[model samples]
Target: MPVAFRLPLQVFYEREARHPRQPFLVQPIGGGAVQTLTWGDVGHQARCAAHWLRARELPQGSHIALISKNCAHWIIADLAIWMAGHVSVPLYPNLTADSVTHVLQHSEAVLVFIGKLDDWPTMAPGVPAGVPTISLPLCPAGDFDYRWADLQGCSPIQDDPLPPASALATIIYTSGTTGLPKGVMHSFGALGFAATHGTELFGLGEGDRLLSYLPLCHVAERMFVEMASIYTGQTVYFAESLDTFLTDLRRARPTALFGVPRIWTKFQMGVYARIPGKRLDRLLRLPFIGKRVGHKVLAGLGLDALRIALSGAAPVPEALLRWYQRLGLDVLEVYGMTENCGYSHVCRPGQQKIGWIGLPCPGVEVRIDQAGEVQVRSGATMLGYFKDAQRTAEVLTEDGFLRTGDKGEQDADGRLRLTGRLKEIFKTSKGKYVAPAPIENRLAEHARIEQVCVVGDGLTAPMGLCVLSTVGQPEARHALQDSLERWLEQVNAALDKHERLRQLVVVKDTWAVENGFLTPTLKIKRNVIESTYGPQFQVWSERTEVILWQD
Candidate 1:
């Protein structure tokens, strides 16, 4: 099916004209209060901001950077950049000063927008000394050249400016789990195709509501919340902070929600903390009480009204999906990358396969090469990596397919099930190759385990290293050790001789973003983990105990 393509600004203009008074953005200020902006309000602010940008007379298609957590002003700033015929470059709000400096210098962004952030002091030094900056509402204390208030009195740009569909829209940097981040360039037409076809495929429209809590710099959130809202005319709500997430969720009562695997796991753990999982399971098996309990639990989480629940950014464990399924929520797994505008595959509502990432999306084509890497071609494919032609040509083929680097297989029905990353496969001392993701996923089925990494790579056999969840932290060491031993035995029973784990080691330190163990998107950095723990691997593997503790 050929879908109609329209630029994001064009769609926003139409929505603004059709329903000027409709609530378009719901932003949570401080102190348990929210300010709802109508389409008219957002249009006026965006137009005024656009006028401010145009007055500066920056070069055509100048790169303008935006650094902020998800907020109303973030979207307004993006609109202003597009209207002023400039390209946007969004930096993750959680990036370090070094990363911020690298992106700004590489993109050559002439101007920057500073918005809501938690750690401004650490990142403020990265903005080059002379670069101009505009501050958005809720921004941390800084000496910005312009503030949101400064744009209030400017006359709104009367004419609607429509850039060509092929114009560059944004440059989203990769999460850089392995090395330095690469800038992925996406055109307006590419993003428009994803937003348009995705909205139609998901049956989204004006009645839908979404909460924008994920980092807007991520393609998943940009396509799901920012671009989708413009295409579907849906209302977007911003989460205030981690402490008030539940409060913000309840206030929004969004009809659609998107969460990553870690968030879902945390939610499950939260539920277990209050109502023991065993007791909740028993209650959910009962006749009339099961329905009531399910409704109550979902309502408590402020997801009772969610018509669509999506999980992406990382592979979700099958056990986690099943747990949510028992609770009357079907978390559809989605698979895509920054190179494809996050619009490749999705598990359709009725046709969801537990472990599979589902079929290719409406206009996406998927294939598996001889090496088992998943390759995708779509209208939403990126133009290429910005200023790195050699690297771009290596990943994107002459035929337009993007090498996804994920090893996967397709069922007879065409659903894609990812096994592991091609680059992550390692050889043991015996020259036996092992893929850690499948083993880690199997070990993660145990409720006590929070994060698991299987390491062997030149060793005789692989071993599992894990960080305990909050639920597992308080349990007696002996009991927890016995439980892990039994779980390890069960998991090993299903593996091949060479693939069986030699032992399980419980690490003392937690894996987190701040400590350099995880990326901003919460994906584990394998190189960092290996470097930090590699010295202890031989000693731990030589131990006799089935479950060893880091001493």
Candidate 2:
């Protein structure tokens, strides 16, 4: 279908008005206290906020950055900006002060809406000189410069029309898993098309409810919440906090859900913890017991009622997907980058191939370039990187396809399987090339392992450095270690002799963004991991068995 000419959110409000009393968002503030908003409330809040934004009289294309977690106010603010004819720039809540400043300066944003303050005051200096920053209207502790309630109270702007679909909609910064994050500019038409196409694939329509916990600042959530909701008129419930996530899940009982691979891994772990993996696996192989256990597992996870549960942002362990399938939750693994307005290829419902990100959505054309890199061009592709024309030109081919930077292969069935990052492959000392991803993924398949980083850029053989050994299941640690070693042997056997893992380094505790071992996208920074644990690598390589890194 052609991208709709009208701003998608405007169409959304019309549907909300038609079903004003229907529950739109169910937010749990805490302590079993729930704040529910009907369709009318969402429409009213958005309208009031839009009126306040218009009163500011900013330039037609003024950029406004919203720094916040997922919340009702975030959506209200985003829709208001578009309704009032401006660009919405979303900043990840946990961004460093340096990154915050870089993004604000790069986008030339005039105003900022900060929701919750974790690193804000320190990050404020990054806002650039002369940029007037306003608080995100959230009532958090510490002095706040502005309140969202005040914005709602501002004089109403006579209901003005929304901009056309061709107008600029948003600038989403890349998670910066590699180099400095670049802002990708997307038009309303492209975003709307992706959403509409996704809606068709999922068979979503009015009355569908979506639990919104993923960061609204990211392209995935923008597509799932802003665009998909607009196209399907689905009720979106904003999660209050991580503590209240499970309760919120039961309350909303969402028909559709989206989560990253990490979250899915956690869910898989939770199920195995409840029913021991061995028992569950044995039961799944049985006839009637298999079906009964699967149903029970699905209901326990509150996914029995779900139409679809999607995982994205990283490659999912095929084992985890199989486990969920055993429990009757058909979790679909999707693939797309920030350069594409999030739905490039999605696993077709009931036609899933575990570990493969299924076929491309309708109207999307994907092909492997000569270098084996996946490149795609579609109505959903971003126009270009914001203010980085030279870099944008490098990624976009003369024919208009966007270079995805990921190596892939398309099977006969059109299922796309990711190989590894083109940049992440390194040559070992023995002159054989190694890709750390498959090795790391294979190691992480062990439930005891939480994170893995395969290093040895110039070593005779690559080394697998992992940071996990059963986070609370100490009794299973020894068995877990043995299982992990066996798994590594199987993986190494598959690789060329020189590319095999010489030894495994099981580092205790977790390596996280806060700890500086991993990037914000949860990808391990190989250089950081190697530099911090260089000595451990030397010792582990000399040992025949898997050696645990002791502090």
Candidate 3:
């Protein structure tokens, strides 16, 4: 199957020409209002902004940084950058001033676009004094050299300039779970191949709707929402804030929804809050009313129309997957990374395995190397890490496979099941190697545990450091302790002697992006968690109790 690479801009131009009045972006404003932009409207704004960018006389292919939460103008700014023959450098909306400065300097970005953000004051200082800044719509109050409103009045660029397929399009920085974020460079061809083929694999097209809530900086959201929308001519809706996420979702009733494991868990918990899990289970057991009841439940949660429910970024628990299945929703697990344009593998609708990421995508080749690491080669593979040849050489093989650090195994059917990160596997004091991800996944099955990290580098056995979920927080301390102790015993019974957890420690502090315990994508920072709790591991292991609460 040969792929015809169509650059995103070219796709956009074609779509705009065919259906200029079709709604492309729906952005939520305050007071339950929304602003809808047609294909023509979006193209006009992007063209106008492109003219503004061209007026600056920056060097061709200059890096321009964009900082924003998901919004209409973020996409506009991205189009403007690309149309002006500049490369985009998108930073996560939630970043510290130091991190902002580091990425800006490292990427050598000459200009920056500031869009919708909650904490502009803290991050504003990171912009160097001389570098120019432009403010997108809904941006926080700031001193910017240019504003979206001002750019909108400029004459739109006359001609549609389609960048070459092989031209550098964007530099997406990793979430930096371990060290400084590395910039992953992607060509227009790479992004185009992924979006074109990926949407085809999922059978998405013009009529499909998507809600864009995830950070557009991440490759998953970029490929799924931004680039996929370009290829498929899908309508995208933006979420306003956390408080109104459900309301926004309900309004859009997206046909395709993508979420990380944490988001899926939160949705499940939200349903549980309205109707207790046991009560819902009993209702679902009724033959006559069960199907309707399930439909009603999903409709209330704004997922009734969802044709494709995708989960990725981290492993979702098998229990969670089964729970959704009972509700008539098949949450497809996708596997990929920043290096592969997030298009390596996906679980097809009817062929999904419980804990496995499905077969390699149409143009993707996957193999398990001698070290048990999953390596992938695809047309969607990135150009390389921006300005980091040494790091690029370290990951990309001589034969062009991107060496994914994840340890995985393939079944006879070629479905990939990831066990753990190669670097995250730790040796216990007894010289037994332990993979924390599987243990953490099992422990996370409990409704009480919102987050868990299994760590015991030099201890007798691994112990779980957990944070309580909303359901667990309201329970009485004694009852919660009893429940956790029972769960711990149940989990241990299924594990080998060396792999069994010694105890479960409930940490008072929640892991969050703000606190540096989690990456922006909500993956636990192992090094941070270990460093924060390493001093007490021995002390906790010495305790005889099956469950321990942090002071």
Candidate 4:
């Protein structure tokens, strides 16, 4: 059963009472010793920030924007916002100026917290005039109306009461893959139920360590890293940057680790770079040396202590799941989104499976409608999309079930396997329809391909726009073409006639959030890809060679 949270503020206070001196946050300061903040430290600092908010005299229940990457101060600001009776509006650090502006205007943010960003100059123009901006610690760039120290100068509030369970806690904007982002409003109860339940399910405890590297703006990371730490009184570590991610991970030695499929895939690729996959496969065959090799590999990555390994945000290829399982670390694929408070379903530890998003979580109900839309009615479901009644009505049903636009079916055992998105299916010129997800997952196993987008609209057979992995460089594309063709042929044989990929076009540049090809959550923006490459598809598809190189 989930722990009742009348207000989120109570959770922190309770944790502080239990372990005041325990390190709650371990943050990396560049070129120096890491900074570790205790529970008491966080409590005092957060209280000061809360008092600072009170002095601003903004309207009660005002919206406040938090724009930055993950950090210790981000959590402090979130707690402070709620403590002062204002709802938080977190913005993705990777968001463009247009997106940042839209969220600010849509949420009606009265003030913004700025920290740990590189593109503040570009993002500065988006901020409305006269709206106060407070710069926080670890901010490598930008000047603000108020510094982080200004908040700490105020005396801490002693008797700030916890808000009602029904009070709005946050307005999380979705990382849009196709269009402008939509803000999903969640209550204190909704967020609390998921966090406390997750702590219970994962068996997280005080000694457990967690690495908070993913964007906190995303609900998945927010729940597992921030809320789980608070509810369980666990230690949380922050990554310094991409350069020191390994150092940070090793320092944390997290017992309960969570990542998106992309991060898991990157881990696999990193392993392969150090030790060739073919060689590792050969070694694993030897019963004597195999276990030692796998153990060493995991330990080297600082993941040896990980009791729980989870992946979400995108469909993980079963091959990726088995790759880690061979190392004795099974990746449990979870199913949920921002609308569900990231608590709809989770694969149990020992009963993990490929392709299936395991049983529904406790107090969560999931069912498939006649149209194959996965629907859920859970305590964690968001109240609604903030102020977008029409859009909210489109996704929610009369019976209070949230209509997830994903197409999927439940097995006899109630395991859900998502097929694809309803709107993502495209009809070929041959009058055949194809789902890209399964195909994408299957092809994603190719070691040489970084990302593959299967495009077949108005064509007889689908072709792929692939970005080469670091191993499959542009200069080596010709040498690797034969090997790539062999893999492509094998993938094609396993698919239905219409679903088979005809050709593979290697694009030069990698798809990234900064490049507009991916969302902040690392989801491929299909619309953006189509717009950029749709014009060149016909010319590339007509090539006689099995592989086409854009560069």
Q: Per-model C-alpha lDDT, please?
A: 0.91, 0.78, 0.92, 0.87
Give the CA lDDT, 0 to 100, for residue 478 in model 1: 98
Name the candidate that leads on lDDT.
Answer: 3
TM-score of 4: 0.97
Candidate 3 has which clashing residue pairs, if any? none
Residue 139 alpha-carbon offset, candidate 3, angstroms: 0.8
Q: For residue 541, what is the lDDT in candidate 1?
A: 81
TM-score for each of the candidates:
0.98, 0.93, 0.98, 0.97
lDDT of 4 at 187: 93
Per-residue alpha-carbon lDDT of candidate 4 for residues 202-279, written as tens digits (9 for 90 to 100)? 787899999999999999999999888888888999998889999888888889888988898888888888888899
Query: How good is model 2 by TM-score?
Result: 0.93
**1 against 3, candidate with superior lDDT:** 3
State model 1's lDDT: 0.91
Give candidate 1 regions above 4 Å deviation: 1-3
Q: Give the TM-score of candidate 3.
A: 0.98
